[model samples]
Target: MENSKSWVIDPLHSEVLFKIKHLAISTVTGSFRKFDGTIITEKSDFNNAKVSFSIDVKSIDTNQSQRDEHLQNDDFFSSDLYPKINFESTSFTNVSGKNYKMSGNLTMKGVTKNVELDVEYGGSEYSAQGQLKHGFEITGIIDRKQFGVAWNIPIRSGILGLGEDIKLIANIQVSELA
Candidate 1:
């Protein structure tokens, strides 16, 4: 962790997405429209990294206004009270070529849990602007109820409600800061 430098997320080229099974036959997908993260590392391989990010919960978008609004309310994320979702890396371990195991603390609605992310490093490159950049596709799954978003309503179809599991993904592109 010596001589570490910070690399910032390029918001224009990065995204955070989540999907959950709705009614057992359908999927509800959403994205956090606003987020930012930084990685502090001393090596190009990123094996030893400190990463963190904050996502604006109110920016959750599923392309449906009504559903999106409900997600930001008390029964769900309760964005008015806890407006930010956060993550801080605990460890980043390389599994092989492009594969990695990323463990971190993920918090939502004031509930925090330890989660592991599967990351695929897409390598690094020099951009058209001549900046060193790194790319990654990260994925993880967590139980929504564990995060205090435990809203369940049964439907006539006997579908119960939304599924307990939530799958998350992040396609990130970051540039080194000199």
Candidate 2:
């Protein structure tokens, strides 16, 4: 049976941020403005909860119009061809201490790869608006090359314009649906 305590993602209160190495020294951070997700709590155990999310590729933002436009081009995300990045949870395993491992299939740039996220639950409580809210913070890393984002321009001093690894961090706020 499905869990009774279900939570709908509050997009207004949630964010999906990513950071990538620039020139092997500095970091470039950006986020997707249009994304949504959901979390379903299991009555038997909260650890058995299920989660899923989707991000719109066109929503990529880096505070610079030109950079953002370049990211959505064919050399990078190719937003016109691959309109979305999706994740579906395959398994949730409790590790030692307060850590948990969430394995899921991440689909991006027409490629699907299995990725593991280190999840930390921030507990649940009732909000002022008379809604039950659950907080979670998840972090993960993905190789940009694995998702077909291997475009790079080599510069002097062994530096490249874009890095191969991308770091993802998500701060999610889920509200129970009545």
Q: Give the whole-model CA lDDT for all candidates, comma-separated.
A: 0.92, 0.87
RMSD of 1: 1.6
lDDT of 1 by residue, 22-93 (tens): 888898899999999999987757996899999999899999999999988898998999999999999999
Q: Give the poorly placed runs of model 1, Cα more than 4 Å off.
A: 156-158
Show the colliding residue pairs in model 2.
none
Per-residue lDDT over 98-174 for candidate 2, one digit per residue giving the tens place of the 0 to 100 score: 57899989999999999999988777788887887877788999998999999999977778878888999998888
Lowest summed-lDDT stretch of 10 residues in model 1? Answer: 152-161
TM-scores across all candidates? 0.95, 0.93
RMSD of each: 1.6, 1.7
**Whole-model alpha-carbon lDDT for candidate 1:** 0.92
Q: Count clashing residue pairs in model 1.
A: 0
